[model samples]
Target: MGLLMFYEYLSRIEALIEKHDDIGLHNYLDAMHAADIAEVLENLESDEQRQVFGLLTDEKATEVLEELNSDDFSELIKALTYEKKVTLLDLMSQDDIVDKLNELPESRQKEIIAFLDYEDAADVKDLLLYEEDTAGGIMTKDYVSIQKDYSIYYAIETLRAIAPDAETIYYIYVVDDAERLVGVISLRELIIASPNRSVESVMNENVITVNINDDQEEVARIVSKYDLLAVPVVDNGNVMHGIITIDDVLDVIEEEATEDIYKFAGTSDEEVYEHDDTLFDRVKNSVRSRLPWLVITIFGGLLSAKVLASYQTTISANASLAMFMPLLAGMGGNVGTQSSTITVRNIATHMIEGADILRTLIHEISVGMLVGMFCAIIVGTAALFMHAEYHIAIIVGISMCANMVTAATIGTIVPLIFKRIGVDPAVASAPFITTTIDLTGLTIYFTLATMMIANL
Candidate 1:
């Protein structure tokens, strides 16, 4: 919805709430989509949010519950009566229910599970065993699978019986008598084939699968690469456990993207999830995440200062050399940050590693040199116009070009090194990159200035 239009609806909801118009509020909510309702709930006060949520029909309530952020979901569910919670959980998807239950205390998880049906409870418990970042954690048990010996007619009949409850019925898996995944057949293929054909004959055996222990990101990569609607999760023995749908992959992508964004900004995504917390806790989280980077930057600042002090004699010989120091440092930091962003993005997309790493580094540095040379010409001319001295112009231009080259080299290499060391490449963030570049840029500038002192 448009911002202004949403605010209008919000205003009307607020007005309705004040007047205690339950019927009107329920009618208004029915007209809005679940996602939109979730947004409205976010803007409302806690008590008001509860009141508004209470008005939603069971189906709408379950949909809205899935749409809410984790914090909101937990808080709202905790506020509801036990019976109400069970009703909503019953309507929600199995994966979504597990996600909500995972956010609650263990006692609460057990309490909710006890209220759920036997199979649903068992599925939730089984899914909870995997690490949250793994493929099994996100996979849903709600998928269609049939015995390999089953005929196409049996498969079609089974799909009809289970299709409504299954998260995805497009790709039907075929398993052996031991329940080991053997092959897969698409819905279209099954429909057109002869009714008497066995699943083993029609199903493709070259099934692309992900290990249950595989990282969620790898699962997303496979799903994207193969253009799969869903991928089967299996144990070492190839016994299929569950299926990861595209919707789950989408959630993982969004989460990883958000986490990377926070990391690049020299912080953790914890702060975002804690946005509703008290002011002090927020500040503490901010310092905890950012202080390490700031410490590194402070150390870099000291080293740069030491470099400047060592070149005091050269600096005093020509104050104009010091004048262009900011230009050199600024250009270097800018180029380095640009290079870092590109490398990090490529790494996130699984494009740069091994031989690709060296190629990316060389390409970025070469591009940086060409860019520096172009900027050097402009700056050198500007220096001549500003200082009207060949020595000053020559020193500044050379330093600028050299600084840019070093910046790109450091920027590209540092992230790759971090990745190799099993650290998140995004932790080689802009602040760290720019700080290191500035320190090196100063050394390059001052060294050139020292060399030019005789002429000055």
Candidate 2:
């Protein structure tokens, strides 16, 4: 619905609730998507949120809970009675239950876990042992698996019995007696195969799987690379654990991309502020996110000042050199930022591997050389037009070319070095790159002025 339409619905909802019209409230909410219902609940006051949420059927409640953010989901569940909370928890997927419980306080998490059946509780507890950003943590325990030796008829029968509880039936995993995943077969294959055929006969033996401890980003990369709907997670012995579905991988992609964007802007945490947040809240969060980066930037400025201070004699002798300093640094920083962003993106997307780094660096340097030559001619001509001395114009031209080449080389190498050392390439963000370029570009420009200016 449009904003005005949603507000209209919200007013009607509040009116019905005030009248204690349970039937009217349920009828109104039941027709909306879970996401729309979540949007409405988020706009409501705490008490109103609870009242509107309470009107949802048990199944609809589960759907809405899944659609809500971590904070909103926790708040909604916390408002429920103990029995009602447990009932909702029981209806959720194992991964969702673990995620929700993790958001709660330690004591509350224990209390909620106690309400689960022994098996479901054990599964959730085991899932909790994995890091939140790992493949094991995101994978769901609900999937269809069949013994490799089983006949097609038996597999079909087995699927009929377990399909209701499985998260996906598109790909059926083939396991051994020990529940180690050995192959994978599509449901389409199973349906077309003769009843007498063994699952092992049709299953693809070259199954692609991820280790439980693999990073979620790596999991996403694998799923995306193979165009898979789901990839199975396994232990050291290849024992089947769970499957990471495409939907979860899509979430990981969005989260990682957002994180990279924030880091590029010098923000620390990965939060994207909502439009509905209060002004004070946004200001507070904005300060919290940007303060550390600003502190670093402040120090960088002081360092640049110190560099300028050291060149006092050089600038005092040749005022024209000072005039050109900003131009040199500005061009270098712009070029460096461009190179670093491309390198970081290529690394993150796996387009450039370790073996490809050397070639990539060479290509960047070649482009840098071409860019530097073009910029040098333009800047030198501009300096001459501004009535600068011939020697000063020549020095500015040479400095611009040298700075651009150096800046581009540094930008290309820094991200590769960070990745080689197992750090996120995005940590060498735009702000950081620009600062480095500024200091180096200034130093290079002054040193060239000292050498090339005849009066100096």
Candidate 3:
């Protein structure tokens, strides 16, 4: 539908909701797709949402429920009957059910799990053995798999019989008798292969897989890097756990990106999402989350003041140095922030391993040196134009170069240390980097000025 037409359709539904026209609303929503109905439900008030949801058939409700965001899904579930909740949960995919269940209390989780059918209950229990952030936690066991010894004809026929129940049949994985992942074959390959040929012959034996314990973000990275539709999950022994599809990876990508963005700002997602539903409460939560980081910055600023106080003898002789202090500090702070952001992002993508970390460190330092030289000339010229003394201009220029190089070096090393110590680089890097660079940048500029001006 056109944008205007869709909103108009939504308006009509909301109008019906206002009028309490249940029959009309039910009839109207019946004609819309489940996803559209889900969108409509999200836009409605809680009472209105439950009213509309109550009108949906079980099958349609299952589809609509799957599409709702986590917060909305949890709220909606709270208003359902125990039987209705179990029925809908039973209709969901094993991985999706586990995801929703994880958000509930431990007692509630067990109660819900107990109501699931035997096989699904077993799958949920098995999947729960892995932490929620790991590959096994997000992977689904519903993908099609073929025995490597099966003939092409049998494999194709097997897929035809099982494809309806499978999450994705784009690539059918091949496992040996030991249930070990040995190969993978695309749907097109299966169709074109000679019927007499075995599944092992045409299947690509070099399978790209994630270990069951691998982090969900790592799984997303592998999927994105390889342009894969689905990647198999295996144990250290090569036994199959399940397959993680592209759809699940999309959620992981968004979660990781949101987390990194928040951490870069010196806060977290929980401070934002885990709050009472009020404008004032949210504002308070956000302020609380940021206060500690800002407090640290305040202390750093005080230390900088102390550093400047000790250099009064130097600044008194060359007051022009005070003017360029901001220029040097700003340049260093900006460069450090840029370098640290890149390092954290690369770490998230698993690209900064043993030698790559050193390569990244050196590469950033080299860039910093070149960039510092370019900025040094500009700032020096500006200092001269401002009619500052020649020595002051020269001192600021040299300090800018040194500070920039040091800023980049610290930015690279700080995140690496955080990662080495098993700390989340994103969560811990930015505030520390910003505070360190600001303190040291001023020290470098003024210390150099102190030494240079003394000789003059």
lDDT against the true structure, per candidate, is 0.89, 0.87, 0.87
Cα lDDT tens digits, model 2, 62-144, are 98898776668878887888888888877888877777767677787777788777878898889888898999989889889
Colliding pairs, model 2: none
What is the number of backbone collisions in each predicted candidate, taken in the order shown?
0, 0, 0
Model 2 lowest lDDT segment of ten? 268-277
Q: For this target, which candidate reaches the highest TM-score against the unseen true structure? A: 1
Global local distance difference test of model 3 = 0.87
Error of 3 at 405 (Å): 2.2
Give per-residue CA lDDT, model 3, range 145-182, as digits (tens): 99999999999899999888687899999999999999
Question: Compared with the true structure, what per-residue lDDT tens digits does model 1 show for residues 1-456?
Answer: 889978988999999999999999999999999988988888888999999999999999999999887668877987999889888887788888777777778887786788677888899899988888999899889889999999999889988998888988889999988889999999999999999999899999999999999999899899999999899999999999999998889999899888888888888886764446899888888888889889988998998889889988888867888778788888898999889889989988889967898899889989999999999999999999896579779888888888899999998889898988999998888889988998889888888777776655
**If the candidates were sorted by their TM-score against the true structure, best first, what order would they fall in?**
1, 2, 3
TM-score of 2: 0.91
Instruction: Arrange candidates by lDDT, descending.
Output: 1, 2, 3
**lDDT score, residue 343, model 2?**
95
Q: What is the lDDT of residue 47 in candidate 3?
A: 93
